[model samples]
Target: MPKKRILHGRIVLKDDIISGYLEVENGKITGISLAKPAISTETEFFDYGSQYIFPGFIDAHVHSFSNPDEGFEATSIGAAVGGVTTFVDMPYDRPHPIDNAAQFNQKAAKIAGHSVVDIALWGTIPKVDGVSEIPGLVKAGAAAFKMSTFETDPFRFPKISDVDIYNSLALLKHSKIITAFHSENNEMIVELIRRLKEADKVYPRAHMMSRPIIVETTAVQRLCEIAKWTGGKLHIVHVSAPETVDIIEAYRQQGVDVTCETCYQYLLLDVHDLERMGPRAKMNPPLREPETVSGLWQRLAAGKINYITSDHVPWPAEAKQKGDQNIFLAPSGLPGIELLVLAMFDAGVATGKLSPQVFAQLLATNVAARFGFKNKGQIVLGKDADFAIIDPSQTTTITDAGLHTRTDAITPLAGKTLAGQVTATWLRGRPIYQRGQVVAPMDYGEFVPGAEFGNQLAPGGDGLVFEA
Candidate 1:
């Protein structure tokens, strides 16, 4: 570690944009000053003229290394280039399911150094009685635990019961952690799918029919109730409906420890686009009507939605297409990791709809606070020196040709111009990306667990049980 380093220019410090100099020592920010300071020995300086330095983004949800050859190192690199310095990935569909402490530890070791930025893992508590593994996964370094409301493949997904959800929440509450759920009603969606198939309405639009907006709102209502009853912190991920946002708002008003996150696709694109893009644009909690998209943006701009993420599940285009026009057969995600920050900045912040301060809160600070990432998401003294240097006035067209994701499913934002670009990104004072190119190796990354709980369990350690 160096004795000191100074970075100066337009700095977004502590949720405010102000012209100041930032000082770092021992890989943490030590000072922010308008007055120049005397240089210490071994001090280095980096001056980003006219560029804005904001807290590096925290992608709260993503999927990587979930299966053999399914990991996206190139997409993770794209994430670095796009101003994301920390990624929290979901654990499902992996060669090893992260249900127990042992599997969580094993996955951690597998991705040990193969990251472009700091990475964290989300552990899943199967809907089955196996949820007993929750505490152990947390001890093993899972910053948060995950459960799904909808069951996809019978073998891959275990339909969580009301009892199962409560037990898992109790376990998480005992472990002093938050539980995030994919809030879609499984039975309702299955019934709708059954009807759609019987009516032979099995088109891309039928997929949306099977997962009507009501499912999300209903599940959110149930989850919030569970959170209130258990006093367990809850976060609803990839919320796709306006009514669901209203439900979250109601929960918050009632003093429920509930927060919600929405994705870029929901804000920028509408359900109609899915017709053109076919399965590529399709995802769980499918895109909604244009009015719903507008309403989601309205809430986002109002700061009702607590955080933002890519939900970036990247599969190769060939694999995503799956030999048919049926959206049901297509994989459930698109690559938005690279575009998340830039797209949000372009569509939200630049439109005067969201202030830069709110951007910081939604994309970086809130994520760090929510996930307990102590040394990240702020330029505070003793905090990690991670930042995104953006040229707010610069314009760029989003295109797959320039992206770093291994897959080639182009963003719908292509041909749509954006007002800003991520010129550089730094992870703990090291410039890992500059001018759209990665300067670091895929394995140069490190697994960043919360400072709240250090590693007490290994990749395959025994599951820890908490007293109920």
Candidate 2:
């Protein structure tokens, strides 16, 4: 007989919150009942009382390999502790990016060996003439493609030229795979940074001043137009300014399949925090002013944003501290996969700005739908039995010493307190994290392929192949 277990809690469903118990058998949710079922000798049962039983959170943006010291083992462990059962790893690895089939396959193998929770991967193209690899990557199980308007590294995270962007989009227009971008105007930011450095203004605030809101809006607007023209699905990652959201909304209204996600820092922290915290709070498309943060919240409440992500980059202290006096020298991004769910609950749900259902949507449901993780996300029958059980009455204090990532001592959120605490996390009906311990094996996680995994590929001439 298949092993059976019962979990009782305040189940957070897609549309409603119910006081119910879920039945799990063979790692899948088989039945849900509002009333507790009769006890059976062969079944094990665990009751979580008033805690919220959320579908395991899915962070659509994570950088496990951005820092060579931090890899799948550390990031996935941190994710499990944060109640994130699965995450989509970015393609920009340290040595090389996943731009072709061989790289994608190698990364996929690494994920299966090291990750403790489920993981998906994003693919990208080379700096030029890389469109030909798209069909091969899709067949190799790349969840989506990521490009950039602003260049981070000329070779690894290069800015895609307009012509290449158009060509890539045209190729992926019918693949139903999203093409996400790190949208920022390269020329404007480069010029501003040059001027700032020349003037000897290396303060933390200068980082924001260098990459103003217009830098983001202009790039996003251009990408949206290209997506509209090519009919490609477009996604803007880590949107900070409200004006950028307005631009995305305008394009979305025109029937373009465009969506945007805002990081928790954008909604909860502001430029003031950046000025106060220095490089610790520093990230690309820097935090907006107080007014802009408020405006972003308004947009989120109005349902203009599709989802939220951590943009979790576990850069070592040396990488962030290098810019202490010269803020422009530090790399962008910070570690947040371990704090995203807890912090969001404290600010969005406990403050009543978001209900439990909406919180689940932003963190899990919408992410799954957007990234094509059909078997994960919601707490429904026939889905994987993954969950993040949160105790509303409990409190968690953030500290670098307590973090699971390799760069635990380098986050801006240290010493912060969040309202709720994740009491336990379940992945595929197995307890991966509970009572501050990671219970799963290092190789327990598996690679989750994207929506275009097994599609047929055929020649479309000009040395290009198209999904048939």
Candidate 3:
């Protein structure tokens, strides 16, 4: 690629946004200039009068599973339109799950040209006995491994046993790969549902009441114990309850290798939203009450939350309405890839709960460092020149037309106007999403192979990974 320069913008740096221009060469940031430069023909330039340039957001949790209506292309379109240049996709795909080397390779090959932005894949153990296949999955280039304590599907998304959890942790110990989990006690949820059904009780609120605080706190507690026992690097995902945050923070203080991420919905919306939205707002680790919401916001400001994501699963309107009268019959999860960055910005930073810098860390920096994306998550010199141009002066009202998900375009964030507007998104110094369309080709995305696998572990490869 030829040299390129992005001129006359407010650049978001480590501590704060600065008035400056940037130079890129070979798809990496090579220099930063604080002063306005005279126009030159040495390089092509994309001029931004006064837009805010933020490190292109990286949503660490998303799903492009083999849904009939939505997959790599649809999700990538939503991602690009939403200003996300990079995302980590979950491993639950239809017909085939990514649990072994062959399956992983096949999925990687399938998504090769279908994405419009950079992507990373999360590998999962498809079944209880699948832990033995982690080595091959890792060797085939999985960025991280994901699992759930509660079963959504027996073979596709099973509740991993304690023995398997210990075994997975042991296998990944010192590997630098973080084993991520959807932490919630299976039996507790099952028994709660059984009791609710037997008592002839059913309501939207029953979903929240069934998975009480203990359900998540208990699973988080168990995960911490297993991780400590096996010396594994663990990450708890979609932590809705503040109790889970308290648990992970306390465990980290004790020196166990641990980290956790709260979903964007957890911080921005609550039980009332769920009650009003029903299956449309349904998700694992159900939304909490008002008081819990207040407490979570406080913790979010305190920096107890390591990062945030949109466990982005876009179920169709019919699928959500299938349960109809019964909340139990309705599937869990919702679409948020197009809403995450803006939602967080509107709720956190613009509202004074998060400083501009901290918000950037949550969406980008912390995630890159936690996982092993060596060149991502920051706007530093030599880093990949991925960025989202923000027009802070602009505000947008959420609507079906404004959204890019393949299914129901209406989101929990609909109706309300948000403060920041993403005008353009660039990946590796090249434009991917610009002026509300994907300018980059389907094959523009490159699979980032796991840096820990091949060359790193061969010969003088340093095995010291996941230390942070």
Q: Sorted by lDDT, highest first, which candidate order results?
A: 2, 3, 1
Q: TM-score for every candidate vs. truth?
A: 0.92, 0.97, 0.95
Flag the better candidate by lDDT, 1 or 3. 3
What is the lDDT, from 0 to 100, of the residue 330 in candidate 2?
87
What's the number of clashes in each of the models? 4, 0, 0
Q: For residues 1-468, what per-residue lDDT tens digits would candidate 2 score against the true structure? A: 876889999999988999999999888998899989876998889899999999999999999888787889999999999999999999999899999999999999997769889999999999988887888999999999999999999889999998888877777877768899999999999999999999999999999999999999999999998888877789999999889999999999899999999998888898889999898899988987899999999999999999999999967787789989999988889888988999999999999999999999999999999988889999999999999999999999988778888744477788888999999999998789999899999989989999989785443233223468
lDDT (C-alpha, whole model) for all candidates:
0.79, 0.90, 0.82
What stretches of model 3 exceed 4 Å from their correct place?
407-409, 455-468
Q: Is candidate 1 or candidate 2 better by TM-score?
A: 2
Structure candidate 3, residue pairs in collision: none
The C-alpha stretches of model 2 lying farther than 4 A from their native spots are 457-468
Relative to the true structure, candidate 2 has a C-alpha RMSD (angstroms) of: 2.6
lDDT of 3 by residue, 1-468 (tens): 376666558888889788888877778988788976555676777777688788889999988884556788888888888888889988887767788888888878867889888888888996657777788888888999998899888877778888788878887786878899988889899999999988766677788988998999999999999888778889998888888889988898989999988888888778888788787777888889988878777777788888999998887777888655778888888888988988888887778878878988999999999988998889998999988887878886887556687656347776889998888888898778877778999998877666565523212122223466
Error of 2 at 387 (Å): 0.4
TM-score, cand. 1? 0.92
